[model samples]
Target: MSRRAFCERHDIDEQRLARWAKNYPAPPRLAEVVVVGELPSARSSSLVIELGQARVHVERGVDDELLARVLRVVGSVC
Candidate 1:
């Protein structure tokens, strides 16, 4: 990347960038990726909501309105 392009992209002053470059030369380092938390590795996660004897197998990407309606109908029975 050119000095002009870098400065323009970062909204940095040219003179300040030049001074910083001279003062603090970038150190050679290997690229690293840090993962904080472990994610659930389930193949298919479906919400099996149980209300008494009713077992509603709600799959992912189900419409909110439709889910609500289904729940309301389920609640009426239970």
Candidate 2:
């Protein structure tokens, strides 16, 4: 999805998402699945979870069961 669309849908500024995406590391760690109705201040085209010292971007329509599984892995590693 385009950055502009993401910002509008989530009520966030596009520039911030761009900067975060640029600064974000590869293979992000998904330590948690944050439940947000929306992200107005988010700084990326996708959804991101900030788990203590980790940051993870969630793709469109991620499955809840899968998310829980991923978080389980994060818990083990982190």
Candidate 3:
């Protein structure tokens, strides 16, 4: 049924419903994603971050500043 029909059947004020909807919107819908390529193997010494079209491999004992810089660059590009 249409929103108007629903409101009419329930005796709900459309203006109030509109205000409530604006104040409390529905949660976002998530899209379904399919992985076409093989994922990297999990290693004890490193971590992998997938960002859109970019993949970040972080090894153990990596410098914080360097990782931040790389993430920043990848984030911008991806």
- Write the candidate numbers in order of decreasing lDDT: 3, 1, 2
Question: What is the alpha-carbon lDDT of model 3 when measured against the actual structure?
Answer: 0.63
Query: Each prediction's Cα RMSD?
Result: 21.5, 12.1, 15.2
After superposition, the stretches of candidate 1 with alpha carbons farther than 4 Å from their true spots are: 1-43
lDDT of 2 by residue, 1-78 (tens): 577986797776887556445443443332234676765444545677666566666776565556655655554566
In candidate 1, clashing pairs total: 0
Query: lDDT of each prediction vs. the true structure?
Result: 0.60, 0.59, 0.63
Q: Write the per-residue lDDT of candidate 1 for residues 24-64, one digit (tens) a residue.
A: 33521222334345632455566567665897878876765
lDDT of 3 at 14: 74
Candidate 3 or 1, higher TM-score: 3
Q: Quick one: best TM-score, which candidate? A: 3
Look at candidate 2 and tell me the lDDT of residue 25.
Answer: 45
lDDT of 3 by residue, 1-78 (tens): 666886798767876555444433352222344545664454567767777999898997786557756766786688
Kindly provide the TM-score of model 2 when superposed on the true structure, using C-alpha atoms. Answer: 0.38
